[model samples]
Target: MTNSIKPRLLLEIIAVGILAFAGVLTKTAANVAFPAMMAAFHINLGTVQWVTSAYMLTATLVIPMSAYLQRSFTSRALFLSASLFFTVGTGLIVGAPSLALVLVGRVLQGVGNGIAIPLMFNIILMAVPRSQRGMMMGVGTLITATAGAIGPTYGGLLVDRWGWRMIFIALLPLLLGSLVLGLVTIYGERRPARQPFAFLDYGLLALGLLLILLAQNGLGEAAPLVSLAEYGLGIICLFLFAYRSTHTATPVLNLAIFKIAAFTWLALTYFTTFMVFFKYVFRPTQ
Candidate 1:
């Protein structure tokens, strides 16, 4: 909320970055332990895949709600809640006996990450002036995404040394530190107002997004017709959500922002590079 760099604001951003790091870190960290988890839980590969799939799907479904969440809650409250979710989630996985509990923990962590990632960008956009936003985002992105690059290796080392549970245990201190720092640094919002949540819009968006992703995940597994039908329905739901956003007084998400060419372009670049490239493009199989 300042034109110039402020210590308090810097600290707040740091707190947000920590949440991002933990979220991304946990995401990839869990990957390296799938085999171990399978053995521990006596599950098959498809079932074990749900460990990551569930977390990712939960995160994806929760992401669209970020706009609604930020509007409804304070920055501090959001940050604190995010940190707490992750910390609690970590604790669950650290001692979880069944695959079900581990999935529950991952989903909780996903919720925290979904809330935290967008909240960081929201802060930079609202608090930092346009002149400084790019630099701030660069710093924020680097800090947040760094954990992803190191996560597998970090997890491998921990799993090698102390077993899969150590991966979660290792994160406990950082998550706790982020929790305390967020409480001290983030103050809900600069100014606050109450607005009713747009449930129908959220429902449409969440359903559409979930269907689309599920279709993708079901590729090569389900009948071709089923996947196509799911994908088609997802598109229809999204179209209705967009139409409602334009027609209604208060849609959960402001789809109108895509009208801005620069923003839309940047969004597409991010989508293709992060969401599509590794997963779809350049894959050995079609």
Candidate 2:
């Protein structure tokens, strides 16, 4: 029994690692192609930055609903869907005839990445034993961090050697393999009845995404006031989302997670670290 379980656990770890790689691939591809994208589109630095910023904004806006999605779909179904979305988006970027289509592809890839990361964690927690969960979690974090660290360098190399389209093309096999493995290993593990779709959640998500888009566009154009207003509206939507999440019985995001002291502190730390990093990166040097 132990021998058999070991192989299965190894496979699960490999699957999670691959999923993390896919998430990192999206970022790597974008970073690698950013300079080329600007040159090809004849856009300035600020405009080209949107290629990455838009993806992040979209991902952040959608990530809050991941818990609801996990409840509504089987693991296999969700993983497959994420793979397909990511692969299709990658294809779009590869075959894009215009900058607009490329941006659309980036947005789709962002959604896939946003969904896949949390789902990977959920699957690991479900499959791994309690006694070994800590080890698995550490491994997962290491995989994620390693991917992030190497992503930019790999992307730069690919873009330099084969042009920007190769970055997208490179992801196709990984996504397909992940889809196949997920179907084999994770299918039929759980069958929660799908709940009725919530229109309110969709509405709020759309509004939030729209605000992010507007803000990105405004910022690109150097319209600080317009960007500020757009971001302000986005904050309002987030507050509304928080209120609905907490007060409603069938909340999209489980607000109760924030009540855990550890989670609360982690969230605070993450926010501070992100702000500090961004400030350092963007600050003008003398």
Candidate 3:
């Protein structure tokens, strides 16, 4: 039993590792192609910023609902859905004639990324023994980090050689390959107990996140007073979202995770570190 289980865990790790690499690569790689896209699409930097924001916001909004989705669908079903969304989205972006269509494609990719990321982690935890989970997670992190580090340079080279659309086209084979592995290897994976999704939980949570992200992104573009008001409104919506999440029996955002003091502190630390690093990095560029 142990021998058989170890090989299965290895296979899942390889599959999930590819997913992780693709997720990180997608974000970092697209960033480098922004200048090329701006020139080709005949758009200003601000307008083209939506290319990244649309994907990020969609991913952020979808992440909170992942648990609900996992419960509503089988692991195999979720994996295939993620791959399908990613593949179709990449195709659309590659062939898109307008910024609007590109944004739509990006949104689809973001949804796929959101689902794949959490699902990959869940699969690893379920497949690997507890003793090996830490090591495997470390390996997964390394894969993502390496991909991220390489993405900007790789994307730039591809864009320079073949044009901006090539960025999306380049990943087609890898995405399809991951899908094939998933189809073959995801058999006998765990299934979740069925749960009916609540509109209140999904809707408010997404609305709150969307408002906050938009407000933050608009800080530099909007007038000072308007920005302030938008920020205030976003905060209010977030507060309401938190209240609703806690009160609801089946909270989509899972506020209960904050009950763990360690997680709360760790999360705060990460947020602060990110903010500090972001300002340090982007302040000079601006």
Best by lDDT: 1
Give the Å error, residue 12, model 3. Answer: 2.7
Please write out the lDDT profile of model 2 over residues 228-281, one tens digit for every residue.
888888778868877777877777677799889999999999899867744443
RMSD of each: 3.2, 3.3, 2.5
For candidate 1, lDDT tens digit of each residue in 115-207? 889988889888887889999989878976687778777888988788889988977888777777777878854565668877888788888
| Per-residue alpha-carbon lDDT of candidate 3 for residues 110-212, written as tens digits (9 for 90 to 100) | 8888888787777767677777778777777688668867877777789779987888888888887888788777764565688877677677667766776
- Which of candidates 1 and 3 reaches a greater TM-score? 3
Task: In angstroms, give how far residue 209 of model 2 lies from its true place.
Answer: 5.6
The TM-scores of all predictions, comma-separated, are 0.88, 0.85, 0.90
Q: lDDT of each structure?
A: 0.81, 0.72, 0.76
Off by over 4 Å in 1: 1-3, 129-131, 188-191, 276-286
Give the range of the ten consecutive residues with the poorest summed lDDT in model 2.
Answer: 277-286
| Error of model 2, residue 15, in angstroms | 2.6
Model 2's number of clashes is 0
Ranking by TM-score: 3, 1, 2
